[model samples]
Target: MAVLNEEQEMLRDMARDWATNKSPVTEFRKVRAAGEPQAFDKGAWNTMAEMGWAGVIIPEAYGGSDFGWLSMGLIVEELGKTLTASPLVASTIAASAIILGGSEDQKSTWLPRLASGELVATLAVDEGPRHAPHSCSTSVSGGKLSGTKAFVQEAHGADLFVVAAKDGLYLVEKGDGVTLSTRKLTDQRSHAEVTFDGTPADSLAGGGESLLDDVLDRARILTACEMLGMAQQVFDTTLDYLKQRVQFNQVLATFQALQHRMADLFGDLAMMRSAVEGGLQALDSGFGVARAATIAKSEANRVLHTMSREGIQLHGGIGMTDEYDIGFYLKRARVLEASWGSSAYLRDRFAKLGGY
Candidate 1:
C-alpha cells in the first residue's frame, strides 16, 4: 500500500465509512432489483456529489478539489469493496478527457456541471464486442459523428458521451440521432450499445494524437483500483469464513492446507496493491503512466481472478448459492476482467510497448 498524506488518508477513511454504512452490497441488490436503465439510485448519486466524490479529480477553479488520481483511487477502492453501482468511474474518466483535451470554451461550459455532478458523462470507444480501440470505424462527416459503440458502461444514464471516432475523440450529447440499446451483462451495472447517426459532434483536439490513449490509460488504472478493492474484500471475507467453518470437528482455518492457500493469496494481494498504487502514483507524477497502468491492471486481473475463484471454492456450497454475498463478487469480477482490456489483451500491449 502507498503511504498516504493526511488529507488522502482522511478521504479514504471517510469513503470506507460511507461505503460500509451507506452503500453496501445490499444497496447494489436494490439497484439490481429496481432494474433501472441507469442501474443506480439517483438519490445515492446525489449524496456522493454532495460529499465531493464526484469532483475528486477536477480542478478547484472548476469546483473540484483537484485531489489527483490517487485520492480518486482511494474512494473507488472503497466503493468496490461494497459492490457499489454508481457512475463515478465512468464519469471521472469522461471528465478527464475534457480536462486533457477540451478547448477553453468547452471546459467553461462542461467542467463546472461535471464537477458538481449535474452532468453525467461516459466514454465510448470500442466499436466491436471487444476493446480494440485502434480498430475504431466510427467517423465524422460534416461535423456529425456516426457509428455504434458496443457495451458502453454507464451509457444509459449519461447526459453526454466522450466518443472515439476515426479522427479523434469527440463530445456528443444524449439527444436527437443518438440511440441506446441496453446490454445487460453479469455485473448488471449500466451498460448499453450506443449508435450515433449524424449526431452533431465537437472534436476534443487539444490533447492531439495521444489523447485517446492517455484517457484510456487513466481508465485502465482506475478500473484496476476497483478490482483491487474486490480482491481485498474476498480475501478478508474468506479468512473469516475459514475461522468459523468447521469440518470433521476441526476448524478449517486450523488446517495446514487451508493456511497455505490463504498465505499464497495474501502474497498475491500485496503484489496487486503495489501495482495498483504505483499506477495511481504514476498518474499523479505524470511519468510512465501507460506502462504503470498496464502493470496495475494486469496484476489486478491475475490476482482478483484467483481470489474470487478461491473465495467461492473455500466457502463450499454456501458460496454458490444466490442467498450468499460471496457469489456476487465472483460475477462482478468476471465482467470487470473483460472491461477496459482483458488479461491477454493487456499482455500483448505491454509486450509491444517494450519492443519485445
Candidate 2:
C-alpha cells in the first residue's frame, strides 16, 4: 500500500465515504435513466468543488488548494470504485495543460474558474478509433481551428476544450463554429464527437509537441489510478460473492479451485497498486515519469481486463444481467482498456521509447 501524509489519508477516507454514501454505482444508473444532456448531477459536481477536489492540483494563488496530483489520484481511485461519473480527471488534465504551457494572461483568466469548478474542460485528441498523436489531421489557419475530435470525455457540459491540432493544442470553447454530436458509451456515460470549423482558438504560450506529450502522460497516470480502483472494487465484490454464494453444499469460497483463482487475482492487484503508486511518485518527483506512466497504464489495462472477466466468470449467470453491478465493471473495463491507449498500444510505445 502507498504511504500517505495525514491530509492524503483523510482525503482518501472522505472520498471513500462520499462514494459509498452519496454517489454509489446506483447514482450512475439514475443519471443514465434520466437521459442525455444530464449525464451527471451538477449539484454533486458543485459539492465536489466545495470539498476542494476540483482544485487539488492548481496553485493556491489561482484559487486552488494545490494539494498535488497524488491527492487527486486518491480521490479519483475512490470514485472509480463506485463507477461515479464526474469530470474531475478530464478537468484536471485540461488545467494541467494550461498550467504547464499557458500564457500569463491565459492562466490568470482560466485557472481560477477551473479551480472553482465554475468552468469545466476536457482534452480532445482522437479523430478516430485509434490513439494516433502524430497523425492528427486537424488544421489551423489564421488563428482558426478546423477539425473533428472524437471520444471527448465529459464534453456534455464542458466550458472549454483543449483540442489537438496538427501542430499543437488549441483552446476551443463550446459555442459557434463548434458542433457537438453526443454518443452514449458502453458504460452509459456520455462522450461527444465535436466538429470545429473555423473555430477561433487561443494558442497556449510555449505549447508544443512535448507539452502535449507531458499532459497525456499525466492523464494516463490518473486514469491508471482510476482503473486500479475499479479493479480493486471488482476483486472485493467478487470475493464477497464467493463468501456468500453457496452451491453444491458449500460456500464458493470454500472450494480450493476458486480460492486459487482469487489468490492469483490478489497478486495481480498488488502489482497494479505498485504500478499506480510508482506512476504517482514519478510524476510528483519528476523522475522517470514517461516510463512509469506507460507501465502504470499498461498494468491497468491488463488488471482491469482480467479482473472484470474473472468477476463475471465467478458470478456465473447472475453477472450477465443488468441488475448486477459486476457486469458494469466489465463494460467500463472495456472502455478504459480502449481509452488513451490499450495495453498493446502502450507496450509498443514503451518499446519505441526505449529505442528498441
Candidate 3:
C-alpha cells in the first residue's frame, strides 16, 4: 500500500475532480464517435496544462512543477479512469529522456516548451511489430535520419519527434522528407507510420547509445503507470455494471461466483499497483531502474490484459457493442497491451534481467 504525500494527494484530488467535471467518460465517447484519436477536450488539455500536469515531472527551472514519477502516476491514474486521451504520456516520457540524458542546452531548450504545452513530442522507436528498443531499423547518415517508425502515437499531431536511430537519439522536426501518414487504430487515437527520408536531425550532444536503453526503460515504466490507470477504470466500470445489472432475478454482483471473480481481479489490480509503485520508487531513489521497470511493465501488461478481457466478458452482449463504454476500454486496453511491449516480450526481458 503506497501512500501519497500531501502534495501528491492534492494533485490526485485535483486530477480526479477535473477529469470528472471536464473530461468525463461521455466526452470520450463523443470524441470516439467523431473519429478522433484525441477524445480529450482541447479546453480540458489546456486546463490540465495550466494545472501544471504538463510539467508535473519536469524541473521547476523549466517552467514545470517537478513533482516526480509518483505524482505523475497519480495524475495518470485519474485520467485513466475516464480513458482520457491526451499527449500527456508521450510528452512526459520524451521530456524525461532529455532531463535524464540530454545536455544542459537540450534540457533548457525543450523541457520548458514541453512543460508549458507549447510543444508536443513523441518517441519514434518502433520500425516494425516488435517493440524492442535494440531492434531499431532506423538509421542515421551525415546528420540525417532515414527510416520508418510505425504506430507512433500522436505523430499526426505532434510538433516534435524524438526519434531513435542507429546514430543515436535525434530530435527531428516534423516536415520535409519526414512524412507522417495517419492510421486509424482500435484505441481511437491518431497513430501513424512515420517515414524519415534523409530528414534533418539534431543529435542530443551528450547522449549516446547508452541513452537509448535508459529512455526505453523510462518509457516502459511510464507506460506501465498509464496501464495501471486503465486497469483500475476497467475494474471500476465492471463492478458498477455488475451491481446494477440484473440476472437470474438478482443483481450480478450478488452471485458468489461473480464475487470471487471480482476478488481475483482485485488481487491482480493490487499486484499491478505494487509493481508500478515499486518501479516508481526505484526510479526516484536512484536504484537499479532497468530491472525494476521491466518487472513493473511486464506485471502491468499481464494484469491489464486479463482485466480488460474479463471486464468485457462479464458485461456480456453490451460489452461488444460500440455504444457501450466498456467496449472502448477493452479496445484501449488491447492497444496498450500491444504497445511498449506485449506481456510475453516484457516477461522474457524480465526473465533475462534476472539472469534466469
Candidate 4:
C-alpha cells in the first residue's frame, strides 16, 4: 500500500466511517428499491461533494483541493466497500478529461461547478459495447456532435458529457439533441445509451493527441481502486463466515482445505492492492501510467472475478439468494469487469504497448 499523508489518512478514515454508518449496503438496497433513472441518492452525493471528494483531483483555483489521484482513489475504494450508488467515479473521470484537454475558458466555465457538485458529468466514449475507445464513431461537424454511445454510466441526471469523437474529445451539455435511453444493468446503478444528434459541442483543444488515452488511464486506475475494495470486502466477509459457519459439526475455518483457499485469496488480495496503488502513484508522478493502469485493472479483473465467485461458493446456498449482500457484489463485479476494459482487452492492450 502507498503511504498516506496525514490528510489523506483522515480522508480515508472519514470515508470509511461514512460508508460504514451513513451509507451501508442497506442504503444501497434502498436506492435499488427506488429504481430512479439516476440510480443514486442525490442527498448522499451532495454530502460527498460537501466533504470535498468531488474536488480531490481538481485544482485549488477551480475551488477543488487539488489533492491528486491517490486521494481520490482512497475515497472511491471505501465507497466501493458498501456498493455505494453514486456517480462520483464517472464525474471524476469526466472532469479529468477536461483538466487534461479543456481550454482555459472551458475550464473556467465548467470546472468550478463540477468541483462544487453543482453539476454532474460523465464520459461517453464507446459506441458499441465492450469499451472500444479506438472505434469511437461519434463525430463533430459544424460545432455539432452526433452519434450513439452505449452503456454510459451515470448518464440519467448528468448535466454535462465529455464525449469522445472520431477526431477528439468534446464537451456537450444535456440539452437540445441529447437524449438518454436507460439500460437496466444487473448492478441496477445509473446506466444509459445516450444519443446525440446535432448537439452543440465544445472541443477540448489541449493535451495533444494523447489526452483521451491519458484520461482513460485515470479511469482504469480509479476503477481498479473500486474493484480492489470489493475484493477486499469479499475476502474479509468470507473469512468471517468460515469462522462462524458450522459445517459437519465443525467450523468451516478449521477445515484444512478451506483454510488453504482463504490463504490463497489473501495473497491475491494483497497483489491487487499493490498493483492498484502503483497505478495511482504513476498518475501522480507522471510516469509509465498506461502500463501501470493495464496491470492494475487486469489484476483487478482477474482477482475480483475469482473473489466474488469464491465468496458465493463458500457461502453456499444463501450466497446466491437476494437476501445476501455477497450476491450483490457479484452482480456489480460483472458490470465493472466489463467496463473500461475486460481482462482480454487489457491483456491485448498491454502487449501492444510493450511492442510485442
The whole-model lDDT of each prediction reads 0.95, 0.91, 0.84, 0.94
Q: Better model by lDDT, 1 or 3? A: 1
lDDT for model 3, please.
0.84
- Could you tell me which 10 consecutive residues in candidate 1 have the lowest summed lDDT? 127-136
Quote the positional error of residue 305 for candidate 1 in Å. 0.6
Model 3 root-mean-square deviation: 1.5
Across residues 95-157, which tens digit of lDDT does each residue of candidate 1 receive?
999999999999888989999999999999998877899998899999999999999999998
**Arrange candidates by lDDT, highest first: which order?**
1, 4, 2, 3
Backbone clashes (count) for model 3: 1
What tens-digit string does per-residue lDDT give for candidate 3 at 1-356?
Answer: 67879998898899989888888888777776777544445676777788889998899998998888888988887888888888898888888778876888888899998998888888898888768777777888888889999889888668789898776788888889888777787888879999999999888756555787778777888888888988998899899999999987999999999999999999999999999998888778769888888888889888998999999899998799877887887788778887777888887877877898
Minimal lDDT window, size 10, model 4: 128-137
At residue 21, candidate 3 shows an lDDT of: 89
Q: Could you give candidate 2's per-residue lDDT for residues 1-356 as a string of tens digits?
A: 87899999999999999999999998989888888663788888999999999999999989999888889999999999999988998999999999988988888999999999999999999999878777799989999999998878888879899988888888888899998888878887868899999999998757565888888999899999889999999999999999999999899999999999999999999999999999998888888988999999999999989999999999999999999999998998898888888888899989988999
lDDT of 2: 0.91
Q: Record all residue pairs in model 3 with backbone atoms less than 3 Å apart, i.e. clashing.
A: 37-189
* Candidate that would win on lDDT: 1
* Candidate 2: C-alpha RMSD after superposition: 0.9
Give all TM-scores, in the order shown.
0.99, 0.98, 0.96, 0.99
Better of 2 and 4 by TM-score: 4
Question: Model 4: per-residue lDDT, tens digit, 1-356?
Answer: 79999999999999999999999999999999998999999999999999989999999999899999999999999999999999999999999999999889999899999999999999998988778998978889999999999989999979999999999999999998998999998999999999999999999989899988998899999999999989999998999999999988999999999999999999999999999999999999999999999999999999999999999999999999999899999999999999899999999999999998
